[model samples]
Target: MLKSNIKTLIVIVGPTAIGKTALAIDIAKHYKTEIVSADSRQFFKEMEIGTAKPNAVELAAAKHHFINSHSVTQLFSTGDFEVEALKVIENIFEKHDQAVMVGGSGLYVNAVVNGLDEMPEIDLKIRAALNKQFDDEGLEIIQNQLKQHDPEYYEKVDQNNPQRMIRGLEVFLSTRKKLSSMLSSTKKQRPFNIIKIGLNTDRAKLYQSINLRVDKMMENGLLEEVKSLINYRRDNALNTVGYSELFDYLDEQVPLDVAVASIKQNTRRFAKRQLTWFRRDEDIKWFEPGKPESVINMIDQELKKP
Candidate 1:
């Protein structure tokens, strides 16, 4: 009844703190296959507690790759992940017909599953210049440039986010090609079939889970983790939500309580953005986080599709 003809990549995706890791492990174990992590934060070795990495029990549940595989010092871009993750998946299919990829990072997931556009990399000088212009002229100047250059992306991009706008401008400047036009608008066909399972909960409930998770992270010594990495605070890798907020506390710019509350609020915002990104993928099938059995059943059905 099953095709038995193609390998399958079972992608477990959801907002942060929504239990993707546990579900991915359970599913990987069921298939007796390995897991490839797409969570960008979890890739670095120095960041453990703040990133909410899998506990020893959860990790020993199944084999995983890309966890603690890089250092904050490394400039591991999404392009790097696409190449490495595909290799990992190829090795997985050598031993099993299925493998699980799990993460809250939408861009990294998209990079592996859909493939990034083959755009030329911009020089660091260009990026630094753009950043300086952004700081000096404010976003309106850069926004106007993007509007002039890549009006299509300008319309779709989040206008409030300078990073997105600057990236758009960077591509336009680097190649004179619209970042929108260079996107992998046509999804790349892979050798394997992909089955995407999205886990979501009531929005309010999701926010509450994030808040609680942050509290647990603090209890687990997120502040101490930031303290250890204080020297590397200038690194772009360390400029993330949890660590950055705690870094602010360390800098004496904000009190500890304020930093904790800010982490919860910023994490909720990040989760909302994650949901927005994953929701755009029409291929993903959604389920309540409580009903992982339903997800398993869906995967069973998909694996049998011809």
Candidate 2:
């Protein structure tokens, strides 16, 4: 039996561009519960286009929590998300027995469902110093240092991701502690039964969809969107796959075509990493993307069980 029986809430998770939002909306409407979005990028109000935030019609369909709800300037973390999501769930359960939580961000989802490892607050001075190092010494130099100090973290992390590499090194430099040590500390129990439903399809099909989506984003003035947020380019929220490439283009570091290509490639790689992360979690119930009725029926039976 599961540890807690305080009613089972549904969580629909998968890779980006995998259609989690629509399915989650359907389930929320059927169950008459609000949705607590776990997509880390969607939390910032200024990041709609790049984050692929839910549309007006979807928001009107159900009470969506945490989508475009916070400012980019605010400090947000998985631990903070866990606390806020639980509060939302508590309020939701008061009106309905269960609610739906959905998104592709594995860490945020895990933070809510299981819990997050305790992490120290990052000092702005440390972050600024690291940012300067990235600017002057370049990412390769920092990455090599991390590889030397904590090879385990370097292997698992996206070496191209400055935000992640900096955070890892920050923990190490501040406390003389390995990033893995801090990250693997412990897990706390939550007071709800989490029903995880994952969606996936053929790899080629998924990549094709991602490429097409990138093209659509460009058509929808994604470049213009990124241009407007140039001031906040250094913000963690803008460190995502789509915006980062265009930021490079705008900086004259890369050509327009090259940036667009990088977006497609990076998005594909991100999707693969998302699948790998979720696959490591054995409790997730997997399914192909196009089966809402079947998926809900399975959850309905589980929820109705005595």
Candidate 3:
């Protein structure tokens, strides 16, 4: 069923540096619509270079929301994004027939489009305790405990994400309720029709593109970007792919070359995970990245189909 009589949202999503931004700008221009970003990392003003925020020309071209619009110190989450993005969309729909939501973060996109399950408010004490356990006992120990307690969530979650693991264990530890149980709740209906467009390519070619993007980022002064944000290293924004590996280098845990290679490897892994998450949605209309005309025509066809 159509969720709205007036509003439509075109969401452009894919892995990082797969040309999502360029395509989003083009679509936004085509529709004369504004764009809302679902990328969690790009929200921070201090994270310009590492996040690959749109350059000035692209930013001026598209009416973009949530790009470098928040401070790193502010606590934001998918829930916050859902609230803000919906409000933004409500306003945009006042002046246009469609709006665009674009980013690579799967959870953020799901929150905006499919809606997130309502979980309990986080208990700081429990979170602190879990973090201490992670620090003292190491991540593997926590991961193992989670696997034993909530195997379903362990399977669906990104195992490398310590924050998510900690939150899962926090809920299980506090209420003895499985995190997966909360996640299994029914989806909430939104007031706009949602159209999902997924970008993909041959696995080998995508991985090669990811590797090259990492190399270009390093050559373009990603190190300097991380260095500038050294004071904010403890911020959640720094807990991302490129910056995290650079942190390991700064800590002397590995050589610079190894860190760069690890960034490329981890980014490719992230892209793989993104594909895995997005592929689960049967509603997504997949397209190759280079075929803008085909994608635009496909969207037009879908929208026009009564």
TM-score of each: 0.88, 0.90, 0.93
lDDT of 1 by residue, 238-268 (tens): 7678987788898899999999999898788
**Ranking 1 against 2 by lDDT, winner:** 1
Q: Lowest summed lDDT over 10 consecutive residues: which window, candidate 1?
A: 155-164
Q: Runs in model 2 with CA error above 4 Å?
A: 2-5, 120-129, 147-161, 174-177, 181-185
lDDT of 2 at 45: 92
Model 2 residue 297 CA deviation in Å: 1.4
A best-first ranking of the candidates according to their TM-score comes to: 3, 2, 1
Candidate 2's residue-wise lDDT over 1-306, tens digit each? Answer: 443457667989888898899899989988888999999889999887877888999999999999988988787877789889999999998888779999888778877877767677667788799889998987788788888888766655555667778878887877777876665356676677778899999999899989998998899889999999999887777777899899999999999999999999988898887887788777789888878998999887777666
TM-score of 1: 0.88
lDDT of 1: 0.86
What would the per-residue lDDT of candidate 3 be over residues 86-108, giving only the tens digit for each residue? 99999999999899999988878
Best by TM-score: 3
User: Candidate 3: lDDT of 264?
Assistant: 84
Error of 3 at 67 (Å): 0.4
The residue ranges of model 1 lying beyond 4 angstroms of the native Cα positions read: 1-4, 121-125, 131-166, 173-181
